[model samples]
Target: MKKLALLLAFPLVCYGLTIDEAVEKAVENNLQIKQQEMEIEKSRYQLEQDKNLFMPEFFMDFSYTTMKDTPYTKLPAGSLPFPLSFKQTNKDFRFFDFGINYYIFTGFARIEKIKISKLDIKANRLMLQEQVNTVSAKTKKAYLDVLMARAVVDVYRKQLEAVQKHLERVKEFYKQGLVARIEILQTKVKLSEIQRNLRKAEGELKIAKAVLQNVMNVNESLEVEPVKISLPDTLNIEELYTRALSNRSVIYSLKERVKQINSLEKIELSQFYPKVAAQLKYFYTDQYPYLDPKENYALVLGLQWKFQGAAPYYGYLKRKTENSKLRLRLQEIKNDIKLEVKAAYERFLTAKANLNVAESSLAEAEEYYRMVVEQFKNQLASTTDVLDAESMLTSARKGREISYYQLLKAYVDLEKAVGGSLKDEK
Candidate 1:
């Protein structure tokens, strides 16, 4: 009853990491993902700034000035009814001015700037999505690697234990003069080999765990849950290609970039035209001369035309060239995505076939080992025969473990190529 109480108190602690959880943690913690998120936020702020350009800008000015001599206008004696000389302004004066300046016309340059900023925000968001997909794929592969390494270690440990038991049996047989000394030596040699392999497998498992930790951006040890192997029912290559073209984040980001370039070209073209602006100012001064008012208000309309030696035309051409280059790059990316989808699909199929073969070989190897062990117990099989059978069984188990995880990793690659989960396609 005490044992039962203790069992209930402790229960069974199962520390494990699910594939989804690993991917979630990696996306949440990856530095690249965080950087991309910051870029998106910056782009949003830029968009806001661009939109504000359409609103009026308010400004104020205050100044005080002193002159060495009083300002005056004089005329020659015959030019006016009398010689005109006066203090046109005070020796010291202060003024305060406030005004608003608004662009009445910008040749549509401001409108295009806003459009480009909006496109920048959209492009950055798509880039963030791409980064997330990349991180998730890496995490899935790392998780699978840990699982495979652990399975291989288990296989080696079991083989080592079996070899140890066989060595003891061989020793007893040698003592009874049923087997030669050479047989004992042979068993010991095989035992040493299995021990060495076990050590190597343990080392690999540690390395695999370290890799998984790095991918998850964590410092703790990892215990990954066993994954079930389930092959997709069917793969339609054409559908996959179609989905990849439509769904990939890189493609969308490129398209947004092309749109941004087009907007930039429009802005450059706008520079060839004149700009019109309106200003409203209210002024106050402490001292005024004869014609100067103490307080006044004015409304001004201004037009600015600049011809900077074909600079505007060349700038427009530059944007046009950039737009063309982006279009070509976009096409290149589309082709690359198609190729990736095709390659990933092929690998998944190959892994599935390899896994099936591994499973069949494992079953046959297990049966062969069992038969050889029984024959050895009856003294009808040599020590070499039993050892060879065990080795074959170990190899088969390792092959199966590798094939199983390779299939899982291949599926993850395919999902990343398609830019989403395969389950979503169904």
Candidate 2:
């Protein structure tokens, strides 16, 4: 019968919402998600920058000047003759040059660096997804809190009304000399206390609204109503745990980090190999031969082998060690995630059980309060008994409200811990 009663009451209190609509709206308005998106864009740009390193670079230069008091030139016979008339600061010398440099090979260093940058971009994308998930969860939790606070205010108002009615009955009995004047005064005092508490609840509801507004990035003038959320009958904790390990953004990011580290180590090793490059230059000069140096087109092929006294080998070994450390850290992170998933699953079960208990207690307290009111009206119970029952009823109402929101939050936390959605059980 109690279950039937609650079922009947549910319709009057049930809210309306669709999951897609809520998520879409939150994504559009959430500032943190937008910021994360910007970070992803930055990473993409960095990838582009790294990719450009393999392309040829072209440049052009032009200069005009005259010099005086310069050193003498040697004749074709290799004997220095009289000093040439030269400008110290060149007054009539002009030339133009164009060139392109192409690195044919650099120990595969650039290629590996680009690979590392690409991996970093992938990691950044995963981080962005995590940010979106975290912010949405926070917004949903705040929304639920506002709903619970509103429900609490309703409970307090009803309790206050019940107290007022009981006080009136006590006053009437006292006027008829059936109850002591002290009893009537005590009833009045209790009524005042209830009112005070109700007012406090009302203020709390307002604060909850403000917090919701801040999170949703909504206007204060926009009102929000509780939307009904249906719960699943049961959960498969193991499946959720599996999904979390595979889908969690943090884990994916760590995997990408490992790839990036490996790429970096390859790049470091590349430094020990030789680099080959090709260069071409074209120049034009307009001044007299005596005033401006001659210019011509030229092509050059080059190879560079830098041993740096075996410094590069030391650097390569250090990078390999760093990569090893990164791998260990990633393993540690995976272990931590496993523990988190286990804890979150347990918390969800606890919250579910608590919701059930709170529901049962709320029903029992409401029934007790109703019976006590009837007893007082029939002159068989005292005002204290009525007050005590009302207080119990208030406690039960608050407990149920709190537990419902807590369960909702716990459900969200579990989903986040697993890196995906846990749709209400069927």
Candidate 3:
């Protein structure tokens, strides 16, 4: 009969959502996921631009110059035995040049550049994966929180109804002169207290719902029934530690950063070597209308070896140092995750034990309440004793829900520590 009453008390909410469905919706609509995807495309475009460095590049040039005065190379008055005549030209000059250069070598710098861009794309992909896991974990927790709050409301309402029935019994006893009038007054006070508590629980339920909706990025208020997610059947902390070390996306992305550093170091080393290039050029010049030169073209070979200050060498060494630090940091992350798995496993076990105790205590409290009520009806027990029994029962039930919800949250944390979704947890 209690079960039927609990069922009838539940509001028939229209929407029902599983945790997995919520995770899917969060990932699909999440802005960070879109940004990471765009970064991948940006890397690809950068790769194309780097490759274009080796392709033929064309350019054109035009220039005009004017001096205020005509100038001539004048001989000293008696510097040479032969007679000299001074010549002056107009102070205007114009020219045009066109060329194409094909850069063929950069001490393998081009090859390393391509590799770095590719690694960037891979890193961005890992970033997307990490975002998905993070969002999914949050969604799972929030979704379960709504359910936990709902359960608390339900528990409070049921207990409130039971206390109301007790209040009526006490009133009847007072009318029969079997109980003092103070007993009826005490019962009414308890009823009012439970009603206030029930209101708080209902308000909490609404807040939990709002929190879940906010996570899902929905504007409309939803009436969702969260499907219960069961705890894992078995937990192996050591196994989870090993899996997290191997499968965590954060570690993978850091490893990719290490790869990028290595590629950069190689490219920096390539800068010290000589580079060869081939070029083709054409030009035309006209000092005056009657002195136009023919269209001229040339094929040229080029070699370059430039010296850099000590800063570049220092940068190369810095790259090496950065890679070393990242490797150590990755190892540190693994240690941290191992510690998390251990701690979460312990909390889960504790919550599980507490839940068991709460369930047993609830049964005892209910039996005691029944016996106390019967004694009160028979004029053998005081009304205060019956009220105390009912209070104990309510406390036991409330404790049970608290423990159960704590276990739920701990289980979610455990899954996160293992670096995966609850459904696929090992």
Measured by lDDT, the strongest candidate is: 1
Q: Which residue pairs in candidate 3 collide?
A: none
Count of backbone clashes, every candidate in sequence:
0, 14, 0
Output the lDDT of residue 199, model 3.
94
lDDT of 2 by residue, 216-326 (tens): 677733345666666667877677667777887877888898887777777777777898999999988755545344667799999998877767667777878887888
Overall lDDT per candidate, in order of appearance: 0.90, 0.78, 0.81
Q: After superposition, how far is residue 150 of candidate 2 from its true place, in Å?
A: 0.8
Q: Could you tell me every candidate's TM-score relative to the true structure?
A: 0.91, 0.85, 0.88
Report RMSD (Å) for each prediction in the order shown.
Answer: 3.2, 7.4, 5.5
Q: Looking at candidate 1, what is the lDDT of residue 132? A: 93
lDDT of 2 at 171: 81
Worst 10 residues of 1 by lDDT: 286-295
Candidates ranked by TM-score, best first?
1, 3, 2
lDDT of 2 at 267: 77
Ranking by lDDT: 1, 3, 2
Q: Worst 10-residue stretch by lDDT in candidate 3? A: 286-295
lDDT of 3 by residue, 307-393 (tens): 587665787898999999999998898788789889988998898989999999989998999899898878889878987888898
